[model samples]
Target: MPQLITAPGEAVVNRYRTSVVTPRVDAQVVKRHVQLGDHVDAGQALVTLSSVAMATAQGALLEADTELRRVKQLGRDVVSEKRFVTAQVAYQQARAQVGAYGMSDRQIDALIRQGDAARADGRFQLLAPQAGTVINDPFVIGQIVAPGYELLRITDESRIWVEARLPVNEAEWIMKDVAAIVTVGDTQLNGKVVQLHHQLDDTTRTRAVHIEVANPDHRLHPGQFVNVVIEGKAQQAQQGIVVPKAAVMRSKDGDWQVFVETAPGRFEAKEVALLRTAGERVMIDGIAPGTTVVARGAFFVQSEIAKGGFEIHNH
Candidate 1:
């Protein structure tokens, strides 16, 4: 496998989750067309709700409609102007009320066609706002629900975010649109850096990075912990020199040092910045690439220098 800059992260649901609601007041779920995990289309009915407010709206519409027709037939000669205007206004108000109660134009037309046979039990269908799978359905048939109650939650899981808290110093590498790898168990997914938080966590001192990954198969789920690898840009990687892991050692001062060979059997300890590690090798800065170093006997060199054979050099 290629060298990776690894971080721990977890999968999260995309922000497009929608809450299905009954648009009218005093609604009770009478029928449920979809259950949890079922995929549904936009405008698909998920449940049928019965409401007193809807029933009243429908009844008033029918009454006002009938009265308007009767007054129109009577003409100005038969009915006073004030009475005629009052009847017209009442019919318009009733129609608007039915619409405000969540009845669609098509539904209102259908009800009008049914006339008295259309019972205004306040029956209305709650539809899916978008095409997605039902992830949550908290209501059962015969359950009394109120307006704005979240009856169900629908989400399109094809796209998701992998949120990771990275060390504050490493935050600079997470640029928007940069490619990242998300590993869920044995599966590896390709994604891109979508976001980076401006502020660091006060407790962890780490910056949050969000990687957007495609999960068309739905294999990645929310709350699943995964491994994320963000490879630095090509130029950044080139700037760091790769050396044997054994060549790097910790100094007494807690700084990472490397043994650079200045002459035959003569090694000098030079402080180097450790960048990334891969297997038995590491990438470091402040060292020229291809320079000779005590790769295998670095620890021996450090011991010899510590014994006062020669004063260790910091450079």
Candidate 2:
């Protein structure tokens, strides 16, 4: 019978993720504009923070600008060239300090224009790096976040992947660019095999197979377990005949046996190899295609053959 290889797996959000982090030193979360599960766009404000270091940087910028302006008012001869150059360098360093504090170029320009009004404010906004839904947010309004700490996570859910594990023995059947199906709840999606792991999982003794599927409506989520049905397109080149599970019975010797009808009312008992079972169907190899075989009452046929009441031959 035509068959499909299946394995259990988990659905994961696609690789596009953005981690929102606080700048350099410790900062207090003053406001949270976005919450968990909120959809955000690129450059949208997600949080507001207050930093002492940012206050100091802004003060220095204001001080440097004041000194540079005061020195410029003096004639070139009145101020030594070395003194003017030193003031200019101080102003540039102050700008660099604010830039390092996570202030964008436009914000820096506006602050420079605002002069003392912008000094010591220290209020800064953290914007989303990409358009995605917020999946993780671990901050409170008054929380103090350490330097470089991740405040939130944004994930693009337009597409998702299923990571399935197959036994090492089945590794030979897995290949790149194969067709696969992922089933989650009542939803079944067609996916493409995107990756195959070279190493086996030490504990499970299974290899990883990654299948990517489209989730345009954001229906699939990470950490959701699903079933993966892999179509062994290459393995199908060498095929086997399919039979009903009831047609195959276990012999007293612990081997699987099936009865095939060679002629009218004449049956034979043959041992068959079990490949894989899906639902009520079993895929076997010893049976030939298009040959009439007992689909029902197989146990009686096996009993009749065992009793030697009828002629039995291997088909």
Candidate 3:
């Protein structure tokens, strides 16, 4: 059985499954389609904003569209090659500028279908890039926000990360993809080690191990402390008998011993050296293979022996 290393861990949001919402241009928050803690879907409208820069870009696009159409209608003999190319480039640039201002391709197509420059209102909606819960929505309606400002944050809580801190020596025994058990109070959750840090903490001399856990019911939350038991690879080949941990007990002299069945319905205490522990199983020496050792109810056998005043120590 593999050895187990226990460590302290904390649940954290998985950054890979989180998204930040920000505007590319300075805009005023006109309205909010969702509030904090609301579940949202991909392409859902999250908020609406109005920007003067977007209005200017829209007008420029409309003008460029008209000019391009006029140049196309005219014969090549009437329009110079440079004039035709310049009109096409201007139209493309204007379209790209509007898109950069947060106008989706569909919205741009609608704007072109309208064909009325007077209708360029500069209002556009910010959409959810992916399906997630709205963990943060800090902006309010009518607030003027600058470009690159974080207006909202969406995160998928179905799966999260638990960062465990292990001692330098114990961490060296484990590697990525090792199975781990996380204990949150009395509940035990299965996880796997996804990352191992090479650098040690300056204060604790411990290495960080990241374990990914599934939270299908959203029971796990960020900032919660947890106990993590990582299954580590054995440092050496197994050479001892593996038995249930309950089969081993400390004798009166504090030596680890197990109950061995010497005859039918008779048992004797035999001292054994503890080698390693893997959860509820322990590997021990001072015992031979094919030996009839009481795996379960060993404590009961020990109690019966103590009643008879039998010597429990090995010479």
Model 1's TM-score against the true structure: 0.68
- Alpha-carbon deviation at 83 in model 3, angstroms: 2.1
Best by TM-score: 3
**Comparison by lDDT, 1 against 2, better one:** 1
Write candidate 1's Cα lDDT for 21-140 as tens digits: 555677887899999899999878888888888888888989888888898999989999998999999988999998877777777888887887467768977777798878778887
Report RMSD for candidate 1. 7.4
- Residue 241, candidate 3: C-alpha displacement in angstroms: 2.3
Cα misplacement distance, residue 203 of candidate 2 (Å): 4.7
Each prediction's TM-score versus the true structure: 0.68, 0.72, 0.83
Which run of 10 residues does model 1 get worst, by summed lDDT? 15-24
* Order of the predicted models by lDDT, top scorer first: 3, 1, 2
* Residue 135 of model 3, lDDT score: 83
Error of 2 at 236 (Å): 7.8
Q: List the residue pairs that clash in candidate 1.
A: none
Question: Cα lDDT for residue 242, model 1?
Answer: 82
The model with the greatest lDDT is 3
